[model samples]
Target: MNGDDELSLLSWMYGHDHDDPVPAPRLGQGYVELSGGPLDGSLLDVTSWTEDEIATGAVLMTVLGQTGPDGQARYAARPGDPGRWDWSGDAV
Candidate 1:
């Protein structure tokens, strides 16, 4: 038939068809807000974070404007605050 019809057929065959035209979900959907640091008020995407990392209460992130030589910043997640991570200090 038409080109659009053919394309739709191919998409369905390849499992690329979607019932809704809404955009797909973005990467790092789940995020933690930085409380204190150079990245204060910034959101760190932790969607890919593992359970162990979350349980450890610590997340080391490398970001811009870091005065440290290594450019790594350390943060600690507080209890009852899953959406926020407090800056502890520089990692290196």
Candidate 2:
């Protein structure tokens, strides 16, 4: 896909998880543009990200999926741990 198309895809992915409480870093506030696409370019797909946003995206993607890099779910609870049962195995 073209660059704009790719950026659009990234933006959509970034914005997909409405239930995730982890807020994406504010773009202009946390990062400055050196050179690239439109200043208002969407930071969703995977490409159009500031460094902080990319880190956030990685976390969001992992949480939305069942298992993360270590093969564990986004959240886990130890047996006998207080409030342990509240975690869903599949819920992002």
Candidate 3:
């Protein structure tokens, strides 16, 4: 992906609107980026009323979490008894 695409993805991840549609992802430039995800870039919606969804808000479905260092987990909301979130990156 190019720089612009990455920035757009970042904006989507941060769940904020940008005057330029796909705004740059700076800590305080105008967006609040969340930390964690599927890593596949599914672009989970951790916040409500995303700029793109302002017309039609969305409901939370799958969830993702990033723990210390390499620790990471995913809680997918799927059919019948979703699997528990597991993180193998935690150090003992």
User: Which candidate number has the best TM-score?
Assistant: 1
Rank order (by TM-score, best first): 1, 3, 2
For all candidates in order, the CA lDDT equals: 0.56, 0.33, 0.35
> Which ranking of candidates, highest lDDT first?
1, 3, 2
Report the lDDT tens digits of candidate 3 across residue range 17-74: 4355544443433222222343333333333434444322222222333344444443
Q: Measured by TM-score, how close is model 2 to the native structure?
A: 0.18
The clash count of every prediction, one per candidate, is 0, 6, 0
Better of 1 and 3 by lDDT: 1
| Regions more than 4 Å wrong, model 2 | 5-13, 16-58, 61-92
Least accurate stretch of 10 residues (summed lDDT) in model 2? 31-40
Q: Where in model 1 is the C-alpha error above 4 Å?
A: 1-28, 57-66
lDDT of 2: 0.33
Question: Which TM-score value belongs to model 1?
Answer: 0.55
Candidate that scores best on lDDT: 1
